[model samples]
Target chain A: MTTPTSRPDPRPAVTMSVGRDKHSHYSYRDFFRFNREQGTIIDWNNTQNLLLSEDFIVGLQTGLEREVGDASAAVMYTIGIDWGKRDAAHFSQWYEREYGVGVKQSNLLFLLETWWWPFTAQGWGKWEVETESKQKGFLFINLFDSMVARTLGDVGKPVCHLYAGLFAGFFTTMTSKELSCIEIQCYAMGETYCKFLLGGQERIDAANFWISEGASAREIARRLHQE
Target chain B: MNSMFAELLQNAEGRYLHPDELESLRAYVEGIPKRVRIYQVLHSKESVLLDRVMEKFQPTLPHLTRRHGILAWERCRRDLGMVWRYCCMAMLLNDEDYLRDKLLYWLETILKSFKMRDECRPAYKLMLDSLASIFTAEESEIIRPYLLLAKTMLVG
Candidate 1:
């Protein structure tokens, strides 16, 4: 929790930029403020957040499995969906207030990136939203360093149901449409990263069936014409 | 720099910045042009810089072929380019946390997944060497911290 200081940087500020964001380059200092005296971590949008440990995540997942058995994935997904929906509502309010633009009026890619930055700061890992084939009824979201997959180890199955549900929930609330998301590929399944397919329930269910039939992520993308 | 000013302003809600704070502000203000200049050079020749680093890195990872998954040079191209973008942004922001929070952690995971941790040391050196070849000693000095951070996070 370093306080803001105007002391001459002992070292030269050797940063290089490409003229993007000219004066408003996003920085964590402005975004995640740690107030030690108050013992609080407040984000740019003034949201209070926690720094959850790997052990806590692992324990929560395993505990759910023990309590609900095979339904743990579903439970996680449900939680993510609920969390996502809430985040959308929360995000819209802050976003409009901060940017002086309604969420609906903002550029799509910019809007999504702005929405996800806080999540990245919160250690949910980073993501790429592939909208090349969004018109075909679905899109691919590539997630790297998924907190769940990294902590749970490789269990030979998709371990990002929570992310799937989170995307599912967030999109549903934002779009005012019923949408579903499925983790088509996962790091826990020995992939380099996690990939989620977001689309209508039918598409997600079809992807689920394809996974049950041993379809790879590439195959799923091909079937969906996402390539 | 922006947040620092914001903090000073917040503190000034009742009282003005004292001598110490003004002196601090002078230091940060003087460094802004240097950062912007570094960014200008790096941004103008980013493609050339990236290609140079790749050219230098090629012989080191000989076993990694384009046909190989993450081990391939092709994969490195994309990730390396991405790293460069963030590095430039981080440097321009003149903030180390900008690099770590925004990109390095995610990149470390991606690298580990590809089992390319061994690539960091040489890559870091090569990038530094490339920067040295391109910029003056003073310029390279400023860029070194961010590169060092990338090396540490990706490999250590």
Candidate 2:
């Protein structure tokens, strides 16, 4: 860490019409700090200080696999679920403060988009939820340009366990129900885009089994509905 | 120049920063204008500078556009605007400590990759020149030292 310094003050202060806190909104600009002398970035806020280094992310995902062997996906899922729960609790506070405690009264799609805006800012790329099937105990999330999968490339398997865990965790808190999520299609698996299915653990487990049994995303959905 | 500001530049002995100057730095940062005259000048110069920047990065345009889509230039513009805001804030604050912290923060967290770091220097240099062009002779004299300090923070 570099130390702070004092410098020569320039011209006398002039008054401007800008709001004092007008620039205080959470922006990607506030995401990090710069150290001029050391030529490095320092994390800013405590809660929002996570860095977006693709190398670090790739290393972490593969590092977990090296350390835990076959169970790394499960471990990643568990971490993501916990992250989602904590994020939800923090998010709800902000949401309530900004929009009031009216999650139900808010437009559902708009609310979900609001929830996702920060992630987009953080370079997680754009995402959309399949609204019609959300009430049927299952929701589909289409992720365009997943940073994780894009970084890792076409690895030939469903590799977005972090996203799966995040969706599962987010929905579990929002709906007040135990939800599990799994990625049925992944960019790593040579898919054009990444897709996830969020629902009860039983439904997710069935999908996971089908995934292992060589079922396509559409086939998994069709087979699940027919059950 | 204030005594506090003088002490900050002196303390930039190599890469090590002294921790004691934080309080003065905070006060200085708090005093910066939310919007500055430089921002308006830079805002008007943005389009031309962006085009120049895009042309400079034309080699990587295909890959960047493929990954980030056709709005790559737009995204770069938005980020440049954001960074310029921070730079203006640092200029107003006029403390090496404040500028250093603010600059490092942006580079590390926001521009977390090498590709952005590579493009940032030339883009900022162009912006500085553009801002300087709009200054009167006397105004240029007054703003030069502070602006130069900001430039140093960016390039370093």
Candidate 3:
């Protein structure tokens, strides 16, 4: 989990030749304002039990318990921030401080890039990372329909729903012990969450769930039940 | 005349007849002059052309002689390329198990026939690409292992 001083290139090296949609540009600030107006932020924060409600947490805990069996404790953390040039770097720093124990440099960097920018900006992508430890444990996960608004150039209430469901799924499954810290980098309108995990059996298990064939949010829950 | 015809038909019934038998049959039928009667006789029976070819070039497993089976298989493949291509297309469209099996059988035959020929490379590539495109995510999972085998054979 020792954070590297130099940041790796966040973008894919190969250039894709797909054409972009010609329409209006949706800023992060606009997205955030719309979410606030629709009470998405409140629901996300659980201010009045509207967002990130107790029930969601219970369901998540239930799933985790099924997967890991009896756990000593479980906790959930929310991270958010505004748009800035140094946001990614700052997030990386916080992640290292939170989850740096026994995490490999390559895996940490790959996780940061995959979660922070690609998943946040592009809507969907997959990441696979292996620890540098003697056992070389690995983690894999994919985000789907997360960047629909950005990629498809359309935004409204539907985008918020997709984002909330995906992030909520992530938040519910991950534990404080499994993750060192949660970082939220804010933009003009919206924010991205980056979760860092301290290498543990649970984290590896979660990673396996992510890459397993035919895995989805529902499938992961079924797997947790079977376990 | 009926007995003569019966003798001729009985003579050609089974076994690999000489190539001259085919030519003589055609000539004898043409001499009948009555087109409808000739059509009735020929249409009533299956053409033994395929059987004759099969008899001439016996296809054996493990391909006893390298040149014999391989060369015969090549001729059959070239003759049946159109049929194989159609089978490949059908498999892509319907995703039928039987069609896919047939396509693979033909591909293997072609590959074995032209072991190191240039045609093998493109044919294998086309088959792989078609499989990748045609199969759904779930079906692809089942088909991927075979695809990998074909890929290794093409490469090695």
RMSD of each: 13.1, 14.3, 27.0
Q: TM-score of each candidate?
A: 0.59, 0.51, 0.18
What lDDT, from 0 to 1, does candidate 1 have? Answer: 0.77
Residue-wise C-alpha lDDT for candidate 1, range A1-227, written one tens digit per residue: 11223333221232333232221223554455566756666655567767778899889989999999999999999988988898898889878877789999876776787777677767788898888787777889999999999998899999898899989999999999899999989999888999999999999889999999999999988888943
lDDT by residue (A157-222, candidate 3, tens digit) is 122222323333342333222222111111111323112222345743573446345343345434
Let me know the DockQ for model 2: 0.03
lDDT for position A121 in model 3: 22
**How are the candidates ranked when ordered by TM-score, highest leading?**
1, 2, 3
Off by over 4 Å in 1: A1-26, B1-156
DockQ of 3: 0.00
* Candidate topping TM-score: 1
Per-residue alpha-carbon lDDT of candidate 2 for residues A128-211, written as tens digits (9 for 90 to 100): 677557657887899989988999998898788888888889889988999999999999999999999999988998998888
What is the overall TM-score of model 2 with all chains considered together?
Answer: 0.51
Q: For candidate 1, lDDT tens digit of each residue in B1-156?
A: 355566777887877789999987887788889989988887787778778888878887776764365656765776667777777777776777778766775566555554567865677667767888887787788878888888789876
Candidate 3 per-residue lDDT, tens place, B1-156, comes to 223345567887877666776786666566444434433432332123223433334433335346444575556445334333323333233233333233333344334333443434444344445543444454444434444454444333
* Candidate 2 docking quality: incorrect, acceptable, medium or high: incorrect
